[model samples]
Each structure stands twice: as structure tokens, then as C-alpha cells.
Target: MTHNVAILGASGYTGAELVRLISQHPDIQIAALAAERKAGMEMADVFPHLRHLSLPTLCKIGEIDFSTIDLCFCALPHKTSQEVISALPADLKIVDLSADFRLSDPEEYEKWYGNPHSAVEMQKEAVYGLTEFNREAIANARLVAGTGCNAATGQFVLRPLIAADVIDLDDIILDMKCAVSGAGRALKENLLHAELSEGYNAYALGSTHRHLGEFDEQFSAIAGRPVKVQFTPHLLPVNRGILATTYVKGDAKAIYAALEAAYKDEPFVELLPFGQGPSTHNVRGSNFVHIGVAEDRLEGRAIVIAALDNLTKGSSGQALQNANLMLGLEETAGLMMAPLFP
Candidate 1:
């Protein structure tokens, strides 16, 4: 059966990405494109790369007939997402690509996002959308919150180890490098080509990065304790992908085995041979996540590295993955394409 889908915030990076992927999908049709600021503009005009494909013109959210939209992907920015999603039809299946519904508690949401959640009831119903870990919940959920790209990358490496108790939770550290597109399509002085092209620097030091909230909430829940890892994110000069190098105190061999066993049957996750590291290039433009494990020279230590396209597997691809479960479609539908390689 064909599912009619609407994409809100259709002009943003993730929103455009959803269009790109969904356009190629066999069971889903793009029925509406909502980009408030760019309403009435042709999608091809806004994104020349998409000019080859026929698509709906951008329009205001209210103009779209939700009665015809079987599913919606909300790629709107943080504060705005909650407000908009709160008013959608209660029965519509939604995959939200914002931080608005990630945290379970309103207090924690305010603590991290700096505002009270306006949709308390919706927050109570939204399922966390880490596809591999929360498959069952996502399948039954009316709303699924896509995790931050960095958070998704890090969790791909750490969640298994944490669950198996193979690592020391107190000493975990994550050093991640993310591409500029992960910052979204907004205009910013720091994201300028002249400024960001040749240099890379870390921001949100001292565990202040907002994704840390997701890490804290997810990891702690798995471990049944307060588990906070030291996380620092660096912005890379490239356009896509995320490479997260995690340091943990554990038996390297055991950690590798744990990860290998955890994702053995999972379709999107690939574990490299022991001691072999992954590069962002391998998973670029694909929904695949390549993970590697290296035994440090020091005994009882391991370095776990994970790589994936920040825009694909980290956001849009993830949203689509959850949408498949919600719609009772094949879990891997429209996402089996190979990575774009040089």
C-alpha cells in the first residue's frame, strides 16, 4: 500500500534529505511540502540538485490537507517543533527530527533546551527513536523523536558495552568530529566557508553540549544509575559524516565481542574486524554505521570508533527507519542503497 507523507520544514537540510530518500521509496509518496518561509517556491528552485525529480511546491503548514497525509516527518527546529507537532492530528504517525521530544521529563527538557515543553501530553506519548534499541516501542508509537546525530553515533558505540557491563561507566569519554551540515542550514558567522574551511575546533566543552542530555538519559536508564560520560564535539571542515572516538576502561576483546554480538543481526550496523578502524567515507550518504574496536597498548583499555553520514543515518534515514516500523512496512524499505563512494 502506498503511504501519503507530508514533510514539514521541507527546505532545511534534513527536510530536503527526507524528500530525497522518500522520493525513491517504493511505498511512500510525497503528498505535501511545507516550508513556511519559502512557501509557493518550487522545491527544485530551492534545491537545484533535486530539480530532476517532480515534487510538490512548498506551502504553509495549514495549507496542506492533513486528512490525506498518512504520515508526517517534522524536521522543524527545536522550539518550533513542539508547538507545531502539538497541534497535529492525534492519530497521525510522526517522526520528529528535533530535540523537542527526546527527553522524557519536562524539567530535564527545560534544563537542557532552556524552555518548558509546551506539549506535556505529547511529550508523554513520544517514543525515543533510536531505531535499533527501541524498535518495539517505535513500532507502536504515534510519535517517535529522532536522536541528535552525534548522540546516535555515540550510542551506536557505547550502548551495547554499557548494557553488558563490560566497561567502566565512570571513566567513559567521547571525542566526536561532526560535519558542518549537522549544524543545520541556518545562516551563522561561524559556519561561513571563509571561517570554517581550513580550521576545526571543539565547542560546548565541559559536558555542556546539548546532546549530553540524551546521553545522560539513555545511558543512565540502561545502566540503572547516573552515567555521565565526558563528551566533546569538534566541527569538521567537511560537508557530511560523524566520526566518534570513544575511550573506555574495559577488556578490549570483550568489548569487541559485546558489540559484535549486540548488532549481529541488525541490518544497518556493521562492526569492523577487531583492531580495524572505520572512516566516514565508507558510510557517507548511506544509512549504514561502521564501528571499530581497538585494544589500546595499555592493558584493560579500548578505543571504540564509529562513523556514519550525519544527515542520513543520523537524521533522515533514522526517521524513515522508524516510520517503516510504525507503518508495518518492511523495516529496510527504501534504505537499502549502498553508500556513495568515490
Candidate 2:
């Protein structure tokens, strides 16, 4: 059962990652590669690291043969993904690595993205691709929306606590730090090596980061009430990974027990020993998320930390996990690689 796959934005960081992972997958074949600006060039020309594989030449999405592709990984940008996916064949199964279909509410989508959703019909059918929490929904979904990297990291730490009622819902705060690769392969003056290499700083202060829309929507639904957390993201100097430190109001022991109990049977999620925190380097380039819980200075309050490679567990790897479920393959197929260690 070799699944024939296509990547729509095959030249970006996440797109290249999808290629790297699928190239090693025993049950998946890279059938097509589409990069509008880089069309007509070989994948090796766009990414020399992938020179070893015999991949398809880059082309435009309009030129792809959807009838031959069993699955498509839409790695296009936010607004662009919706436009392109709207034009794709309705029968084609898709795992969109964009923000377009993540939020179920179109109004919320517009509020964050500043435009109406052009593909509302598909949005209604797309499952939120959290992999671990949404496994059953993803298995039956024709379209799956990959969660935002920061949102995924924060949720991995808080969702279990919320679900188990181990923490006070009104006082959750997520302070996350992410690597530069999460910004994608696009060029920006601020992203220049000289400017970003030696410094780290927080941005999107207050509740303004776009991934907050996902947190608001998902956490609220899980608690059967509105759940809003104060979230702030920092830009780190490194190239990959996300470390989310969460501050919650709860008993330290209960928080630790809740997280361990929730993910004890899950393969990709690892709960570190109580009182020990995780670091970004520990989960580099892998689908695993390591989480830890400890007591905060304030009584009855706990600090939770979660770490994972933003590009893997946070994006492409998560997409592959959902795809496995959709295809009825083993949920962990082609995703058993251990995290890169120093």
C-alpha cells in the first residue's frame, strides 16, 4: 500500500521537511512536487540536501494531476492555501499545513487573518490535526488542518490539565520560544543571520499572536466554556524547535499526575519525571514532545514545560501522523525516528 503523495509548496522549510520524511517512508511515494516560483527546476536544485532522492520536478499547483495523487500536503502560506485548496479536486484527501482550515469558525478566521474564508465548505469538513487528541476524527476526515506550531506546543502541555480538571481554567498562561525555521523559508530583513543569530526577543505581546485563535477555540470547546489564556511568543536564535513554559494554578502533584496519566499510553508524547523540565535540544528533528511539571513559587500553582521540534511534531510529522490515520495505516507508521541528541 504505497501511497502516492504530492507536496504543493515543496521548496519551503516545512515542505522540504515533508519531502525528507516521506522519502524515508516505506509506504509512501513522492509523486509530485509543486513550487510556483521554482517550477521547472529539480527538487535537488531547490534543496541540495534532498539530492539523493529521485523526486519529481517542481511545478505549479495548476499543473498537477490530482487524479494520480492519493494525498496532497498543502504547505502553502495561509491565505494562499485556501485559494489553492479551493481549486483542488473535492475528492482528493489533503493535509493542509496552513492556518486556513484550523479554526472552525469563519468569523474567527477572518478576525485573525483579516479576510473571509474562501473555502468555507471545505473548512466545515476539515478536522483539526492535533494527531494525539484528534486521532479518531483525523482517521475519518477527508481534509485535515495542521495545528499552528506554537499552538500545538502549548496545547500539549495544557490540554491534558484542562481535560482532567486538574488546573484552574481562568489562570493559564503560555510563554513560548520558537526557532527561526518556524518563520518559513521566506526572506525578511529581520531574519537576516546578523540580526537573528545572537539575539532573542518576544513579540506579539498581549493576546495578539495568531495561534491564540486556535488556543481559544480548542480549549473553550474542551471545557464546554470560553477559555482564554495569556500567551506570548518569543523568537529564538536557533533554527528549529519550540519550548513552551506554561504557568497554571493547580497543585503540583496533581498536575504531574494528570499529565502522566493522560499520555501514558501515547507513543509520541513523553512526560518527563516530575520536577524535571525539558529543553528544545532534546526533541530536535523528531515527532516526540517531552513535557514536565513542577511546583511554582506560589502555593497551589504549578509550572509546566513542553518541548518539541517545531517542524516535526509541530508540522510535517504531525501531518504524516494524521495521514496515517486517514489511510487506515498504523498511527505510528514511518514516524519512529528518535530525536537528534547533542
Candidate 3:
């Protein structure tokens, strides 16, 4: 019952993470690795931390034989993932870690990505891979769209509130901070040590961050109407987690009760004791998401905080979770690593 897996963009952070997790999986085997730019090089050359494990040499996607792989993890860039995944064999289970297939509407995809979706048929079949909320759908999907790290963080705190009518839909606001790895492994002048270290700043303001589209889509759908939350994200100098603090007009007791009740049976999601907030360090390197709730100084309002490793629960770990479902294995399999702490 071991699944043979391939990582299409094996040189990136998320792809390397998929390698790390799969290396420890008892029922999955790494069959192929593809990195268009790093083709023919050993995976260890691209990511030294992975040197201890036996792995395939990186190759181009076109060279992979889909018939040999039970599933593929598409960790390519947004626009690129759409094009690459579109050409992949239809019968292969795919967990796309890019923004390309997350949104259900093709027009919205073009609006956010600034390009038309080249694979409308596949886009229509891709299941939104928010494991907690879309488990059943993902379990049966041939293609699963992994969520944006930021979007996943915010949703863990707010989705239940929206579902239970515990928060005011119009007054929601999210202030999120993420580590540099969430930016991806690509070189960017702003992500350089001299520029990023020792400081933190917000970007994509004024409701312009693309992950907001996911928020709008999921929240609105849950409320059965158009719902928008004011969201702003900041880049922190560190390298691995996301802490999302949400401000909502709601009764603290009700909000706490709703979240606790909603995730009561979920393994990866933990609802902290009321009034106790979470720290990104607590969940770093693990697939677990911790959420906390507290009453705001303003009456009829509360603060909801959620924390997780942006690379793990937010990306690769989530992809693995969905893949387990698609393969009919236990959803939490190969994802039981505890968060790394200093």
C-alpha cells in the first residue's frame, strides 16, 4: 500500500519540506524529483539538510513518467503551476501548492494572478485543499489546491466564527505576520539579509493581497453571502511561521465556544484555553494549528489568534494531509511530528 510520490518543483522550500516529511513516511516512497532549473543535480546540492536521505536526481517535469507515480506535489510558482499541472496526466493525484487552482472561479483566478487560467477543465476539477473544512471533497479529488499560507492561518481562526454566527461579518479585521520562507525560495532583493533582517513591515495593503480572494471566497460561501475581511500581512525577519490575529465584533464566550466545538474532533487543530493566546514558536515545524480567543477591550468584540508553521501546516504538511485523503490512507499519517522548539 505504499504510495510512490514525485515532487515537481523539488528545489523550493515547500518541495524540500515534502521530501523531508515523505522520507519519514512509512507508507510512501519518493519515486521522482523534478526541478527544471536544477535538472540532473542531486537534491542534496539544492538543499543540504536533505543530504542524509536517498533521493532521485532532479529532472525536468516533462521527463517524469506519471504512470510510476501515485501522486505528485506541484510546488511550482503560481502561474507556472497552472500550466505544468494542466499538462500532467489526468489520472495522477495532484496536490498543487500554488495559488492557481485554489479559487473556484476562473475569472477570479485571472483577477488575482493577472493571467487567464490555461487549464479550465482541471481547474473545475481541483478541490480546494483546506483539510479541516474540505476533508470529504479532498478525499475524493484527483487534484487538490493547497491554500495560501496566510489564507490558511486566518481561516483557522475565523471560519468557525463565521459558521456559527458568533462574529459580525462586516467588522472583521486580520493582522497577520509571517516568516521569510513563506515568500518562497526565489531570490528577491527585498528578501536579502541586509534588507529583511532587523525589521518588519506590511505590504499589499488596502485589501490588495491576493490571499484575500481565498478569504472572500471561503468566508462568503460559509455565510451564504458576500463577506469581506480587512486583512493586512507583514513580513517578519525570521524564517518559518505565521501568527494571525483577528479582531471581530462578537461575544468572547460565544466565540470561544464555537471554535472549541468546531475543532473538537480534529487532530491537527488545537483550540487553546480561553484567554490564553498562541505563539508562532509553539507550532513551528509542525502541522498543528493553535488558536486562542480573548475579549477585546471594546465590548461586543474579541480577538482571535492562530499560529502555525507557515511552511508545514500552511503548505507542505497540508499538501501531505490532502494526499493521504486522496490515497485513502489515514489523514494524519506521516504528519505527526511535534513542533520544533528551542
Candidate 4:
């Protein structure tokens, strides 16, 4: 029952991560690796940390026979994924880690991503890959769109609250800090060691972060109305993990109760005790998400926090989780490794 898998963008961080985790999977095998710019090179050359493992050489997407791939993880960048996936075999099950198919509406996709979606038909059929909330749909889906790391982290804290009506939808706010690797492995001047080493700063301020589109769409759907949260994202000096501190107007105990009840059966999401907060260090390099709840001194306000590795649980790990469901494999298989900590 081994599923032959192809990784479309295997040269990047998320793709390499998929290799790392899938390597440990008993029921999944890496059948092909595609990296357009680094074609013909060894994956080990592109990622020295993966040198010890026997892996396929990187090739252009078209060189591989998609007909043999049972499932493909499309880790290509935003717009790039749609084009590549649109041409892929129709029957090929896919877990897309890019932002391409995450938003359902093509108009909304254009609004956030600045371009009309190239694969409108496929986008319509794509299931949102928030593993915990969309388990049933993911199990039956041929194409699953992985959420943005930031979007996923924030929703882990707010979705249950919104669903239970325990929190005021109109006043929700999210302050998130993410490690640089969440930006992707692409080279940028700002991500260089000299520029990003010492201090942290915020970007996409004033409600401009693109992941807000996912928040607006998902929260509104849950509450049956337009729900927009004040979201501001910052880049941390660290290498991995994300911590989202959410402010909501609700009874503290009720918020915790709703979250606990919603995720009581979820394997990867862990809820911390009341008044205790989670740190990114606790979830680094793991597929686990830790959520914490606390009350503000003011009576009607409460705080909810969620933490996870931006690269693992946030992207590649999430893709792997969905792939498991689509293939009828154990959802937690190959993903039960403990978190890496100092």
C-alpha cells in the first residue's frame, strides 16, 4: 500500500521538509523530485542536510511521468502552482502548499494575490486543507489547498471561538510573530544573516498582510457574516516557529471550554492549561500545534495564543497530513515524531 509521491518544488525549504518527513513514512515513497531552476542537480547538493538520504535528482516538472505518481505535493510558489497543477493529470490527487488554491473565490484570490487565478475550475473544486476542521472533505478530495502558515496559526485559536459564538466576531485581533523560514528559502536581501540577525520588525502592517483574505473568508463563513480580524505580522530573528496572540471579547472560561471541546479529539492540536502560554521553542520542528488561553484584567476580554513550527506544522507537515487522508492511510502516520527542543 505504498503511495508513490512526487514533490513539485523539491529545492525549496517546504519541499525539503516534505522529503525529511516523508522519508520516515512507511506507506509513502518519493517517486520524483522537480526543481525547475536546479534541474539535473542532486537534492543533496541543494540541501546539504539531506545528503545522507538516497533521493532522486532534481528535474524539470515535465520530465517526470505524472501518470505514475499516486499523489503529488505541489510546493511551488503562489502563481506557479496553479499553472503546473492545471496541467497535471486530472486524476492525480494533490496537496498544494502554495497560496494559489487556498481562497475559493477567484475574485478574492486576485484581491489578495494581485492576479486573477489561472486555474479557476480547479480552484472551485479544491478543498481547504485545514486538517482538523476539514478532515472529512480532505479525505475525499482530489485536490487540497494548504493554508498559509500565518493563517493556519491564527485560525487554530479563533475557529472554535467563532463557531461556538463565545467570542465577539467584530472585535477579534491577531498579533503574530513568525520565523524567517516562513518567508521561504528564496534569497532576499532582508533575509540575509547581516540584515535579519539582531533585531525584529513588523511588515505588511495596517491590515495589509495577504493571509487576511483567508481569515476574512473562513471566519465569515463560520459566523455567517463578514468577520475581519485586525492582523499584523512580524518577522522574528529566530529560524522557525510561529506564535499568534489573539485578543477577543469573550468570557475567558468559555473561550477555553470551546477550544478544548473542539480539539478534544484532535491528535496534533494540544491545549495548554488556563493562564499558561506556549512558546515557539516547544513546537519547533514538529507537526504539533499548542494553544493557550488566558483572561485579561478587564472583565470582557480574553487572550488566546497558538504556536507551531512555521515550516513543519505550518506547511510541509500539513501537506503530509492531508495526503494521508486522501490516500486512505493513517492520518498520523509518519507524523508522530516528537518536537525538537534544546
TM-score of each: 0.99, 0.99, 0.99, 0.99
Clash pairs (backbone) in predicted model 3: none
> Which residue segments of model 2 deviate by more than 4 Å?
none
- lDDT for each residue of candidate 1 in 1-342, tens digit (9 for 90 to 100): 899999999999999999989988999999999999999999999999999989999999999999999999999999999999988998888999999999998999999989989998899999999999999999999999999999999999999999999999999999999999999999999999999998999999995789999999999999999999999999999999999999999999999999999999999999999999999999989999999999998899999999999999999999999999999999999998999996
Ranking by lDDT: 1, 4, 3, 2
Please report the TM-score between candidate 3 and the true structure.
0.99
Lowest summed lDDT window (length 10), candidate 1: 204-213
Indicate the TM-score of model 4: 0.99
Give lDDT: candidate 1, residue 243.
100
Count of steric clashes across candidates, in order: 0, 0, 0, 0
Model 2 per-residue lDDT tens digits across residues 20-85: 888878888999999999999999999999999999999988898899999999999999999999
* Residue-wise C-alpha lDDT for candidate 4, range 163-241, written one tens digit per residue: 9999888898899999999999889999999999999999999867899999999999999999989988999989999
